[model samples]
Every structure is written in C-alpha cells, then in structure tokens.
Target: MKGSALTFVLGAQEKTCYYIFADKPNSNVGYYFAVQSGGSFDIDYTIKAPDGSIIVNEAKQRQGDWVFIAEKVGEYEFCFANGMSTFAEKVVDFEIKLDDDFKAELPKAPDQPIAVEGMQHSVDRIEAKLNDLIKSLQYYKTRNNRNQSTVKSTERRIFQFSLFDVLLMAGMAGLQIAVVQLFFKDSRKQLV
Candidate 1:
C-alpha cells in the first residue's frame, strides 16, 4: 500500500482538482479529506474514474472517506469545490492511497527450511493493524485542528462584542452629560 497526504488552502469560490494514476486494474483506491478550518468547514467534492464516470459526488461535506476498486488503468480525477463560500477560505487535508493486492513471493535459499506460513500471516495482520492505527490518529488530528480554529474564532468575536459594548456605553454617557450641561446653561441665561 502506498499513499500521499497533503494540506491546502482553498480560496472562496474556487475549485481545485487533482489526478492520480492507476497503474493496474482492480487496484484498491482510497480517498479521504477533512476541512480543518474556515467558513462552515464544508466543501463540495467529486471523484471521477478513469473512464470519466462519477464514482462519488457530494456537496457541503465537512469530511469524507471512500474506497473503491479501480477497474481501468488510467488517471483518476479528484476535485474540491468551494463555490458556496463567497469570502472565506478553507483549510483542508486530504490523502490518496493505492493498495495493490498482489503479494510477491520472497526468494528463499533451497538449503534453508521454508518459513512457516503462520509467521507470514502474523506479519500481515500486524501491518493491517498498524495501518488502522495511523488512520485513527489522522482523524483525531483533524478534529483537534477544527476545534482549535473554532475556539479562536469564538474568542475573537467575544472580544469584539465586548469592545463595542464598552464604546457604546461611553458614548451614551458623554451624550447625557452634554445634554445636562446645555440645560443648565439655558436656565442660567433665562434667569439673568
């Protein structure tokens, strides 16, 4: 199994597309993506097979994980669209994986005894478990990033609101003082 992972910023109203080559037919292809920050943490995505057939299409998705068998040997297209956002950009993380099911036989010396098949099975099992662990870790990382962004955004909004409230109160107090002073001045002149 081989894979590539990437993080990118997607601008508002922008569409980005990528391609991955499938060298062998019936290969297992995996696609995963998460929106780490910005806007509503959502985007549209589409996956097209080598023959231009749509394998997956979703709108306003925060994250996705998909696996499918590639039946044709060619380039597969993956696209992310942020047209729903008019001003805010988004941070996204994605991974593309290609897993070849064919296992190559290891060359062994004739004089040496053949390795036990059970040992090989154990190694394979361990590898699979490790892969699952990696995937779980990635998911947790994405969630953490998103939560941090949300916290920062909320903090900023709270500060702005507080500042505005203070300013408004100060302005009202100044206005009231001016009105009282003006009333006293008019009364003094009328008394004279």
Candidate 2:
C-alpha cells in the first residue's frame, strides 16, 4: 500500500493548497501541477517529484507561469496565473486530492498488482510463514532459560549464523538502495 496518489486542479486566482503525505513509512510519492496564463488553460496538470529529493518542484510552462506540487508532507507550494496583466484572477479555484494509502500502513504495491485472489494467496503464505517464524523465535528465546546450554548453542549456530541471515541482509540493503535510486534518477522524464 504505497498509499500514494497524485491529483490537482487549475486556477486563475493566486492561491495555494496544502496536501498531506501518505501514512506509509518512508514512501516516496507526491503530486505536482501547474497553471498557465491566457486562454492556454490546462486543468489536469500533474506534480512532479523533485530529483534527488522527496519534495516536488516546479516545472516549465508553455502558456503562462503557475504553481508547483505540494512537495512536503504539510504545506505544498502553489501559484496562479490569469494570463492577463491585471489583478489576480478573482474567480479561480484549486482542487487537489491525494491518495489515502496511508490508511493501510502497508508496504507499497507488491510485485505484480495483487488481485483479490493474489491477496488471498499472499495471506496464506504469510500465515504459514509467520507461524513458523514466530515459533522458531519463541523456541530460541526460551531455550536458554528452559533447556540445556548445549541446545541453545546449537540453535544459534543453525539459525542465527545460517546462510539465510547473511543473504537476507544483503537482499534487503540492495532493495532499499534500488528503491531510493528509482526516485532520484530521471524523474522528470516520467512526470512530464
């Protein structure tokens, strides 16, 4: 549940709107939009995530100058252009709606969009694996106090020092780095 959504609106009136980031921990998602002057109006504009930063940034324009996406979790920056060299467009409105993935507090969308059936399959896998993981952890936690030291010592060699731990750490770090890089490189190409 990346809980990330991007939405925005157009306005002629000079104004701003603040959008809240999703609740997911460390998820990098945002909204970006722009407004142009003159009749060259575009309402369905998108916000781009800034390169090498979690915050979104302003973009180039063809019609006139306008706003940027709300990059931060709190106050998102915005601007308005009426195309005319006059007072700020008095009759303009902004409509920005962000996704509410924060509600689930889960990881971003899983590998392959999990359909309803896929979710059931994932739940089943977790149920099977979680029980084993919990039981193994519990056994080790109590073995030191309830059983002989020899058994505990052997458990450490098999479970704690197993190839699984080393490989898992390497994989986790590799994944984290990959995700971080995915956002920083060539972001505008995707947003534009």
Number of the top-ranking candidate, with lDDT as the measure:
1
TM-score to true structure, per model: 0.86, 0.26
Q: What tens digits encode model 1's per-residue C-alpha lDDT throughout 1-192?
A: 778899999999999998899999999999889998889899999999988999989999999888999889999999999999999999999999988786654455556535645556677888889978977987898899888988999999999999999999999999999999999999999999
Model 2 RMSD to the real structure? 30.3
Q: In candidate 1, how many Å is residue 176 off?
A: 2.4
Q: Tell me how candidate 2 scores on lDDT.
A: 0.42
Model 1 misplaced stretches (Cα beyond 4 Å): 104-115, 186-191
- What's the TM for model 1? 0.86
RMSD of each: 2.8, 30.3
The residue-by-residue lDDT of candidate 2 on 1-192, one tens digit each, is: 222222333345433444444333334333223232223333222233323233333233322223233334443323433334233222222334344333322344655555655766777788669956944554454333334445555788898677888999999999999998887776867877
